[model samples]
Target: MTVEYAPGRLADLYGEPSRPTVLLWHGTQTDSRAAVRVLAESIAELGVGVIAADWDSHAADHGRADLLASVRFAQRTTAGAELVLVGWSLGGVTAAGLTLHAHAFGVTIAHTVCLGGAFMAEDPITGGPVLADIPASAFRAPFTLLVGTADDVIPVGAAEDFAAGLRRHDWPVEIVEVVADHGSIAGARYDAATDRYEPDDSAGTAVTARAVATHIVAVARHA
Candidate 1:
């Protein structure tokens, strides 16, 4: 399947790109780089390449296929380069899936950061149980799963269970909970300048972005 993607921006933040790269997957109903522009900018400042993937708005299979395509595209775009996968909301779950599917694209995924991943056995789109089993290598790389205390969509119970399950599988799973709603946890830290969503506070985005960036750097250093 040809990965259908909407064009995205890739501005060089520093002089030359000498740092690692990250593949960012946005949540549903939002652009690939949504709520993550600030984080991307910060990472870019460190000389890391950022590919904020934008998918066809109409094609949404709980974002699985889109994310797969993103991994493939990243493989081709960043060949012979180090990669870290970052996903918010549905994109988070996609990040997990990529750990196992990266070989299909001939890429070696170094790490993953899942922000408010709806990763319960229950599918977010169908509310059906996830049929696929967690891969043994899923947790081989370090992963940070960040959720919100006030998130109503992905219940806290489910998040805990999912994290526990990954840990049991020997995956390095770090779960962090913040004070915010689902959208906020995903970094849609509503901006009054744009006025597209609510909770026009940058609290969640600021905190979560820092946490993610810190983890990314730590993992890269150790890897």
Candidate 2:
């Protein structure tokens, strides 16, 4: 169920906090945690703790504090269980920034996962756009990026471009091309009326979410 991780900052907690817990960060949509719920629950069902955080992407500081607050909550929940950071949409870029700058954040990420990431934007954590030539020296941990071939909102090549940049820097990274669209990868579909990604029960969506969850669990197990 969802709870307030900090004052006015909401989060959805899944399963019991354990070693190698996942911190699922959502996209820039105001729906926040809702955007990642379906996939988060799928991971939780496989016995991993997942915390899906809700933050204001339009906040004065772009909800950096809100994101960090949820991170702290995950830390407390895990009690040193180690963290696996996962990001969707713009959250992927921010998480990528945080992963590269992990030392500054004072967090050790076991593994990082990006889902249909939009990389051409400012990373709230680093306050800079994700450029192509970030030196390999800045690499802090391995990254697994999931790209959607059918994604309409963000082109697949965008993520491929970022993956190429990571490879150019010799950063440890893996890219998985999923045969799903933007929201279906997260077990959601955009609702024009609500302007949010609501839960989608289509058989195809379930398949996509399950595949993504399986990949996530594998990453966590090897972390």
Candidate 3:
């Protein structure tokens, strides 16, 4: 279903939210919900609800309002249920950054998953690097980084390094490497002409997305 997460902003909520809800955030290049259509459907089909929201990374406040708007919508509507957060690329860092202040926003996130995330860049929330002089008590939830082994955008080793850093601070984290590129890990392919990712229907795309979908459902079941 189409949802108005914020005024003049929209999101797609797949499956019945009466079940476990997973708020999916798209990456930086574009705030288009279509970018994650395939992955949302995949997760929804696994008996989980998925909210694929759009947030403009190029906004003046770096899309902070749009991002938190979705979180508020999710929190108030779900009644503090088992809501898992998933983000890709820049959105991953943004989601992780929110953990530093979830209580301030009045939300309880069960778990967070970052897929091919850009941990080295500035997150949308604090507009700073993710792991520099942050407190061990900053985060409020466990995290799982799904590293695409074939992702040339962010190397697997770099993801591991970030996870190691998180672990050093006692942030519960796990690394699950998948055999796909940055885009295909979420059933998308980088479009050179538009400089963004678009959905692809290849078998490998389904395979990789299914891998992520399974993990998300399993995590929600436990959360």
Candidate 4:
């Protein structure tokens, strides 16, 4: 469903709010709803609610303002609910940031999941580095990193490095590898016409989706 808690900003929410809520954030240059629709639905089927928020990271404010607004909306709407934050690629970076500073938003995140996340990178909004060796004490929840072994966009080593950094800080982290690429993890392909992603239904896509979904469910169960 479409959520318009803030004017002009839309978020797609899947599953019922009574279940565990997962706020999903998409990568840069992609719509959250379209990019994460398949995965969100898959997670919802497992009895978990997912919210995919649409925010343009390339916007004038670097999408940070919009992301914070979305976070507030999620917290307000899902009050007293167990909230898990999930993000893909750039969105993953943002999710990690939010989890580290969740106290500022007056929210407590149960856990965090990052898919093909780019961590310890420079922040476009602040013109400085982001997630560069964050202290473990800053994080109150565990983190799970899922990346494709064949991912070309963000190499598997990036996830390993991030995990190592977290481990050094004595943070709980788990890394899962899937047999697919970046786009295939979500069963999506670029649609040139509309500059968005379209779902793929090949046999291989189905298998990969199932594997990823299973791993996600396991993570959620443990969280």
Number of the candidate with higher TM-score, 3 or 4 = 3
Using alpha carbons, what is the TM-score of model 1?
0.71
Residue-level lDDT of model 3, residues 1-223, one tens digit each, is 8978888899998887744589999888657788888999999899988889999999998888999899888876777675688989888888788765566666678888888988888988877887765654564588988988789998777678878888788888999988889998777899999888998778879988998889888888887
- For model 1, residues 52-148, the per-residue Cα lDDT tens digits are 7764334546545555566566666666566777777666766666664555445677887777786763443232443255444433766777777
What residue runs in model 2 are displaced by over 4 Å at the alpha carbon? 132-139
Q: Which of the predicted structures, 1 or 2, would earn the higher lDDT when compared with the native?
A: 2
What tens-digit string does per-residue lDDT give for candidate 2 at 10-126?
Answer: 888888776899999888886468766778878988888899988878888887998888888888888866789999988899888888777667787899999988888888886
RMSD to native for every prediction? 5.1, 1.7, 1.6, 2.4
TM-score of each: 0.71, 0.93, 0.94, 0.88
**CA lDDT of each candidate?**
0.60, 0.84, 0.83, 0.75
> For model 1, what is the error of residue 42's alpha carbon versus the real structure, in angstroms, after optimal superposition?
2.6
CA error at residue 58 for candidate 2, angstroms: 0.8
lDDT of 2 at 92: 90
Clash totals for all candidate models: 1, 0, 0, 0
In model 4, pairs of residues that clash are none
User: Which residue pairs in candidate 1 collide?
Assistant: 139-171
Model 4 poorest 10 in a row by lDDT: 122-131
